[model samples]
Target: MSTGITPSLFHILESKIGKRVLVVLDRSFGFEGVLATVSQNPPGIWLSDAEAVTLRSTLGNPYPQVTNRQDKSELFINLSHVLRVEILH
Candidate 1:
């Protein structure tokens, strides 16, 4: 995946492809929080605390990972792993 600064919308849409999405953990949000996505089933997914930790480590480490914000129990997708972002209503 390409690195650099991208938009949040790009990442949100990427989560739709059934590819394992790497969202940022929103520390501000509480556990069992929810996120918005453009997927056919846009309820998004949930990430456990352990999973969030793993994601954080994977980002800075030698892995093709994405960063995210964690809110206790909820995480948002990082914009880095967004390979191809599109705006489809």
Candidate 2:
């Protein structure tokens, strides 16, 4: 992840409420899922249990293939399975 710029798509989700943006999650070694932002909760340090579950479901399934965007590559990981949340900016 890079510094001084937002990293987690969740944060981007929170920041861009009512706006549309691309969300990328790390599914595996290379696979990723791209989603269109539809809604978001207020800025917070953590996501609620319900939010986590909802995010997880959106991830669907992990893919063996990876995604390359903005010269970066990451897998699509389920947010519900995430252990920690970190901010880059």
Candidate 3:
């Protein structure tokens, strides 16, 4: 039995492989990384060359600032905590 949605999801993910993406989590934090791989058993994603990022409004600047460009070699994100994903150049 299949709802016929999983393949489309996988296709989208596959197309994004090696591209830069921003993944926002349920928490206030998000990450920017290169899409490495995905695991279906537990519904998680692996990101290489990952960096932690957050958006915060500064006093002087009305626009939210992107901060915390901390570098990380690799990261595994549990899909349950993900809020949304955006493709970044």
Summed backbone clashes in each candidate are 15, 10, 0
lDDT of 2 by residue, 8-49 (tens): 755654564433223323332212122323222322222221
Give lDDT tens digits, candidate 3, residues 60-83. 987545666888779998776787
RMSD in angstroms between candidate 2 and the native structure over all alpha carbons: 13.3
Q: Candidate 2 lDDT (Cα, whole model)? A: 0.31
Question: What lDDT score is found at residue 9 in candidate 2?
Answer: 56
Best by lDDT: 3
Question: Per-prediction RMSD in angstroms?
Answer: 10.8, 13.3, 3.6
TM-score of each candidate structure, all chains considered together: 0.23, 0.23, 0.77
In model 2, the clashing pairs are 25-75, 25-76, 26-75, 26-76, 26-77, 27-75, 27-76, 27-77, 30-66, 31-65
Rank list by lDDT:
3, 1, 2
Model 3 poorest 10 in a row by lDDT: 1-10
